[model samples]
Target: MSARLARARRLGALLLLAGTVQATPVHASADQPEFTVTGAPADRRDVITWGASADRMSNAVADRGYRLVVHTSVAGRDLRVRLSNAFGDRPVTFDSVYAGIQKAGAELVHGSNRPLTFDGARSVTVPAGGAVLTDPLPGRIPAATDLVVSIHSPDAAGPATGHWMAMQTSYATQGDHTAEEGADQWTEVLGSWFYLDAVTVRPLAGTGAVVALGDSITDGWQSSSDLNRRWPDYLARRLHAADADVQGVANEGISGNKILADGGGQSALKRLQRDVLSQSGVRTVFFFEGVNDIKAHTGVTAQDLIAGYRQVVERVHAAGKCVVGATVGPYKGWSEWDAAGEQVRQEVNAFIRDSGEFDAVTDLDHILRSPYDPERMLPALDSGDHLHPNDKGMQAMADAVDLNSLDCDSRSRTG
Candidate 1:
């Protein structure tokens, strides 16, 4: 073969390996004088360093304080917190809010606790179906740091919004103890995060984030508690160590979440804007969902699920961002498993693998499925249940993601 033809073949192979089609490049005129636009650099914007999916609260706790522990994904200054009343039926008042570094258990690092305000006011009342963001706290928070967020609701009632399976242990108190940095008053332990949904930080220019949108598996259902072993957590660590511009990760997974309907939480279609697009500095959306919809046997065909996926992709792309779709993993031994559901799962995975509708694809089904059965999860990776993955399986899923796929230029998509 000619040298030119060989080079073309090699390029085609590389693009195939990357799972993306090549776009034609635009060239500038060589005769034009290159005048540089010089001025003060633009201010850096806030990027989400940590987040949890919000779901309807099981019960309401009145006049209570919570000291939540969350792990940061990227380091930066001017930290901020977002509190949600998304599922509340009435107005909820959060009179006190504080942020600090966790030393151990409910104890905070000495002198690290700081008060937070909303629009210069110490207290804010979030209306039903609304949310509030605190003014930036002036300080640098390092990546992978254990940050503590304390909140006290004076007269909170009605439905509460929170993530039930946090996979981390946070503390709670009977009365207003958000001001205290000690663990003495925080005697009650909880496995969920309340009110607070996202934490943002102002990072340097070029820093970006990815949001993982999915169901119980993505929510770290079977993963160890307090270990930060969720697949997204692992992906965050990988991004921090790599040369990729996407260094932050926001996990938007709620247990029993569906792609088309509202059950455990608002459907992925309904919450896409508030949960994914509204996040700061999110360059790409990692879409890994649909198992619940399939297993629920809701008469949803592969076409229905594909339509939902297309809608999500279109919305994200319209926002000038890329999406990486993950194939649904196997769950043949799970209680809800049925041959008809499995058939739908197979059809959906086939589309995700071959359809090029997504900017990129991650074959999670190939990674998590048992080599022997091909329809069941690997026993070693399964956390006793056939559906959710354990820590090892979570790490495997994170490893399957190509780090380079997350770094998409927003201008390229828009232009």
Candidate 2:
């Protein structure tokens, strides 16, 4: 055979072999193990918990609608629904909770939703400071389903705890937007409510979770709920859009969570395992906590706060996972307003901006703080509380973090 002909035949043979390999699915990929927990597989225990003062009340609208949108890739069979009232003073009574496939930026239809049951019947009550796992009989989630969970309150809940992350401003199908509407029960109509607790769709085995840990700012206080304005939520949206290789975010920012001692619900140190390290598929953590520690207590200097930060970093690192530190933003005339505290905050901020201990640094403080008044927060950014940034401000903070920087994938041991 001619030399050219022989080489051509060899190349063709190699191409054929590559095609066969690509066509054949590996057994390991086909039969990967699904996540199994202490609860029943048929039951949906999707609500992840954190927070303080379940008793603290905020007036939400009556008969309002709340919806949770999640984009999931399901490789497992037999899917179900899960809901949460993880932080409640009294029993969190669900007037109605339903789940079903949904369209992008739309309300769930009544006929499409399946009624969820706890134990074996309609309506389950989750006690204060505890959660209930519900049966999956209500819904059958298809593979890679975008599940929408719509729920409403049976009674008034003061201070309806929420981590709002609506990308565009979420609208109330009816009525003016106010804190009072948050207390109102959500009807079965196609209206959007605020706050998304948890959404678990089957993930391909080995899909890692990116846990965004922070304070009320991270908790998304004023970001119009349903609009998906919260930075973390925006990050999730961005990740989904980019078709990134990681699972979506598991946001554990309680309105008042601090890094030092217990404040908002449980301090960052206290809730690390439950919120970040303990999460299934969690391989990376983005830490934006510690403002509360500075704002809540005056005795601790910025140096003290930095020490607390080091401790947090040490704990996170010891777990063999990656930790990204976000600098504390400018807060003026807010809680614990003191020149000394501000000075301390600046010192701590400098450390965060320059810290080499962290696997990555997200300069959120520099992104949102006022340029004219370096100490004072930007008017547009500050929520009326001054300490917490408004929705737009939160978006800027989220924008500041370079998602590309969190390239390391390190899983931590579950304690």
Candidate 3:
């Protein structure tokens, strides 16, 4: 057998033979010793490189370490991570946290793993329904890098808070193995991120980010996993190539999430502060939700959804952030298709397109609908479910967004 294949097989075997591994402590470097900072300037804010909306966690496991792989959107220095226990009924303690560069599967780039400190402490306890951010690790983090955040949770319970559809493959292991940089101990594969929700980095002056708030489509349900083909991912690529102030992108999409009600996760209204406004260096909110509410047949009328949209717009404006609204795309072939839902969708889309409430609007309905059948999705764009879009469709959606609209200034808001 080839040496590489042989090594992979051996690794696979070790992964299946799960056992407790002693945690390795990450020592602070002599030159770059970990320190704490209080009341940092808001202008030196950290922009979110990777974020997943927290929801009730499933498959909770105690005394486990997670090595999550996330892609950064903007390049900058001073990296940090945010851990959430938003849905947990009890406090979750994360004893060890490390940030590093991924070299390969479950492996770290040599000398890249750095210990993360929270308020100058190595350990932190996140209370139920709360979250905390780590002190920035002093260094430069380039854009589009495969950043690995290793976290060891000693006492995790209740519904472990995490985003259900990560679309990325992370690693996990029993016990506290967070400090290890090698792939040998990180044997178990984890499809979901636990405790860790967001990673942020301080970027260039005037650089800001836009948070994409939506449901399954924005959550990247049909996009290929581990490839980062979500629409927001594509939009980030565009922002990097273009001359725009909004270069950072945070996807706060939750599958089955709604703008009006709470079901799949906290409603967009409830999560707005935690997911959008609370993030550092967020300048704009890209609102693209409401299809679930319209199709759920839950007696949600057009006015009800419109009122919800108004609330979102007003709240976002109150935070002094631009709001980019996207009309709901067509979804006719799905089982929930009905004339009443279609009518409500039309009314809502009309309001989204004609209303002057939003700072900017992207007609996703016009972009995704079939030319022949307005109520159905474009077959070429659909991912066969006639609901979610494929990678190409995701790109199309990203392309539909106006880069200039994302960077609106205060004068533009009033104008």
Candidate 4:
């Protein structure tokens, strides 16, 4: 059998492993992560990269039968799975990966006998330099399902595949004082060079998290890797401190996504369902996009861009979820940015600030614009490109968010 088929067959054996077939569809304890990967530098179709890791940390935990961290507090129900090879030269293989519940802080806890499968099979092999989707392994998880997924090499191979989602420096061992000496950084390459996409604990009962979607600015470009200082990461920390029931932030931002057209990725319209709507227990979405669209490739008009935002808002609201809009930051120095684009950006920002269509809105333009010269870019936030926000800038962006508008305490009416 082909590696992909072998992986598929392995998944078929999940039921034979010993465990009681408990009545399923019970709530998962927390939210699962929303992970996806695609190529960058706008318009490269054949060469693919994934959101993965270079070190085998996640692989070790999954292989040694360590429980996924999210299970400690996930809502049980139909859970979502996203396996990727957003950056790989060969087919990526996954062995037996399972998700379930365990006691809080249990590192080695393996919950239930349930395993992840794709298309009714056991193992799965993502195409060389491509991405794949897994079928939902339903009913196996309950409230607080502790996930333990084991990935073995079809042959010997590395774990992560794409650009590292870095904010601050990360250590190989969680809670260990040892530094992640000589670890790879994102700017060194464009894609995940073997990294963990993300892990989401299912929402407990009725709670989930909102994934802030966008580009490198959202990804925290130039932020200290593993510092957990990305705006989204910071927002997560703030939410946790507030004793809010938020599970965690699943950042799907790719570093160059535009709202209306495919540049760094399939346009917002193309990825909305997969990146935003499909998140488990998602009750709200904060839309922070369009800067690249208005200033970069698309050169879309202010009215057209506003219309695009409107479409996104409509779609989210149709799903019974709240939406928040973020104004685009100044990009006076972006390679493609010019006076004309700045004018359009100004128009769009005015609309975002004045528009009541969003459940809530944030003035990122106001926060990121240069105080010295309103038309000029903020030197601190500029990534030298005068386009993407630097670390402090991303943090500022994160700080700018009005968390209250997310409405975490409110219940979602799901279809």
> Candidate 2 has what TM-score?
0.64
In model 2, what lDDT does residue 245 have? 42
What's the lDDT for all of these models? 0.83, 0.54, 0.81, 0.52
Best of the two (3, 4) by lDDT: 3
Backbone clashes (count) for model 3: 0
lDDT tens readout by residue for model 1, 1-415: 2542443343332222221111111111231111111111112366788988777886678899999999999888988888888778888899999999999999999999999988788898887766777878999999999999999998998889898888899999989888888999999999999998888887654567899999988898988888989999999999988745677799999999999988978789877766776667788899999999999988999999999999899878877788999999999989999999999999999999999999999999999999999999999889888999999999999999999888765444553
* Model 3 agreement with the true structure over 1-415: per-residue lDDT tens digits: 2542443343332222111010121122221112111222222346777788988877567898889999999888998788877788787888899999999989999999989987688998877767777777999999889999999987776688888888899998998887888999898887877777777787765567889999999999999998999999999999988746678899999999998888878889888877776677777889999999999999999999999999889877766678999999999999998999999999999999999999999999999999999999999999999889999999999999999888755323332
Provide TM-scores for the models: 0.88, 0.64, 0.88, 0.62
TM-score of predicted structure 4: 0.62
Local lDDT at 303 for model 4? 96
Against the hidden true structure, what lDDT does model 3 obtain? 0.81
Candidate 4 residue 170 Cα shift, in angstroms, is 10
Clashes of 4: 71
Q: What overall lDDT, based on C-alpha atoms, would model 1 receive against the true structure?
A: 0.83
Query: What's the residue-level lDDT of 381 in candidate 4?
Result: 74
Error of 3 at 166 (Å): 0.5
Question: What TM value does model 3 have?
Answer: 0.88
- Candidate 3 backbone collisions, by pair: none
